[model samples]
Target: MGQMRLDTDPIVQVDRKPKCCFFFFSPKIQANRIVRAQLWVHLRPTEEATTVFLQISRLTPVTDGGRHIRIRSLKIDVNAGATSWQSIDVKQVLAVWLRQPETNWGIEINAFDAKGNDLAVTSVEAGEDGLLPFMEVKISEGPKRIRRDSGLDCDENSSESRCCRYPLTVDFEDFGWDWIIAPKRYKANYCSGECDFMHLQKYPHTHLVNKANPRGTAGPCCTPTKMSPINMLYFNGKEQIIYGKIPSMVVDRCGCS
Candidate 1:
């Protein structure tokens, strides 16, 4: 019950325009305990001439069983494109034996360029509450069809063509529980007075002062959520509760739990 050390440094901006960067790692296991996970990635080449391609995936974002088990995938091609600093070793082989009751799991990192396109994608979490797993919606089995190609003129019906089909349904009721803590162990403050919700804006609720307070004019600000000795589980209102610091939770209109 003693072996947990994780380090992550994410600073990416892939120039040629196509970017897809995501890093999410969740570690916290002890139900049947058999965990043994190790992942190390340190690639630095801000710019020298440019050349970087990396891909690592161990499932998540709705499962991809990639041939059932024994997964240990690695692909690295950092041929000294100059700015120096390279080390990529992604390893995960067996020992993930947690039989439920303490969940949060996902590991997916995909970054590419040098003709293959796509650049930026991150997902990290192997065990011991590294936390970063939120976004799940799956319910589609039958009758979902949309394939059209009509150039008309088949005789019998030429005047009965009036098509207008617009069916858009967006429903979100997942009600929070996302974990990813490592902002230097957390310590953020910037919400002087009235803050009910406004930190990523989305409609009619704005009233914040002190942007520097010359005559008191710049609006919106709220930040103060901290608590992580590794408890991780946030979404307090629909219950999944377990908070120590997430800005002290209270700023809603549809943002920040």
Candidate 2:
């Protein structure tokens, strides 16, 4: 999984009566590689009983002067809380900014429908490190390569055992990790058995090393040589739901040292 965090003090538009906070982020990652993206903001505690609606908007230049037009507003409900963090889905919005860099003016957040209630928000300039507004992005190069379990299967009880890959299913539910929303279980697989000089052709370097010091050198042991990832959707420690790929979760191949 890949993550990026950004923080900047937003420019407040005093002209607009309603409070408007603008945040700018530069995502250096490729547009097509982004699998998931989220915008996180910390909302200060409020005593008001009415729910405040936060409107997230994208800014697009409309005139030669320093003016922009807001498009595609994403409204999020802000409930009265005790300094809590809120997450907003920004995958499509971020993709547009990456594809068209010129249109990446930034995002605007405004509070509405609170009568006269004051919506206090934390910013990078005035808030603590943990309370600052930021973003988390998950990126993937392309389609994942599926690798099958190949090679000989051996029994540990047998005396003529050799290096091999064996089945090992990991049950998340059995482990009491209910936070994982998908894939209650998966094939993790394991490597075991032994490594002998008879299969030295598979690892030429190890063969050469053992050949040079045949008297005292130790032989290679069975181990996993390649691994693959698994896509997971789980709740983080902050209780935020996330969907990302966990790398090296599956053993793909087994070989001698």
Candidate 3:
């Protein structure tokens, strides 16, 4: 998804203003994906020049009804003695945090002076009114994965011959893939169109085009199903590779007789 503004107008600011939604898994992000969360804050120097630490911390809900504990924090160091609006990448500090669904997020800051006297920054409630602060979040989907030397993944190139694909398999949902196709001989294995379910007939074994033009390059060999070069469609609606046309059949009703 595109960048989105979370809490805007009610720009809550305080010596300790923490966004609560961040404490938990973000609804914007999906599982196993990468996302960036940002905070836009307008701050002014409440004390002498000092180092400000912007900490991204979280609280986890105890499963055993125990006390909630604080996890390691992601911190961003900044010099904020001067008044200015800064956009901070909370994700840069808290990268890899999206992997967990257990923690809730909040933002906290601490000001440290060279003399060791800790100071506090302007709170959201100060109502000084230079500008309110807000947070923005961006979520993105990750790329598809390819597994090799596994039970299922193979050396099959994608239908577009652009990338390698998983190999052919007989066991629809149970068994693993049989073998991988050679990368050198990679070929496009696009399926045919949608099956003509309304024309559910017996196993025609009708390679009409192939029979008409045996030597031509336009025939059954052109359409390959999830299994092999010969596409298959089933009478009982268990058809495969229905690519917007008549699908193949596999009921064993007539064994090519």
Q: What is the full ranking by TM-score, best candidate first?
A: 2, 3, 1
Question: Model 1 reaches what TM-score against the true structure?
Answer: 0.20
RMSD of 3: 17.7
Clashes of each: 26, 0, 22
lDDT of 1: 0.32
Q: Which stretches of model 2 miss by more than 4 angstroms? A: 1-3, 6-28, 48-50, 61-81, 111-122, 125-127, 143-221, 224-254
Q: How do the residues 173-206 of candidate 2 rate in per-residue lDDT, one tens digit apiece?
A: 9989987755567778888887876778777888
lDDT for 205 in candidate 3 is 50
Query: How many clashes show up in model 3?
Result: 22
Give the range of the ten consecutive residues with the poorest summed lDDT in model 2. Answer: 13-22
Better of 1 and 3 by TM-score: 3
Q: What is the C-alpha RMSD of each candidate to the true structure, in Å?
A: 20.7, 7.8, 17.7
The sequence of per-residue lDDT tens digits that candidate 1 reaches over residues 114-223 is: 65543332333343132222221111224435434211111233342222111122222222213221111222112222333443243233432344356874454322
Put down candidate 3 lDDT per residue, 158-241, tens digits, no spaces: 343211233333443233322211111222322323223221232235444435665853322213323313222111222111
Q: In model 1, which runs have C-alpha deviations exceeding 4 angstroms?
A: 1-38, 41-70, 81-95, 100-189, 194-257
State TM-scores per candidate. Answer: 0.20, 0.54, 0.34
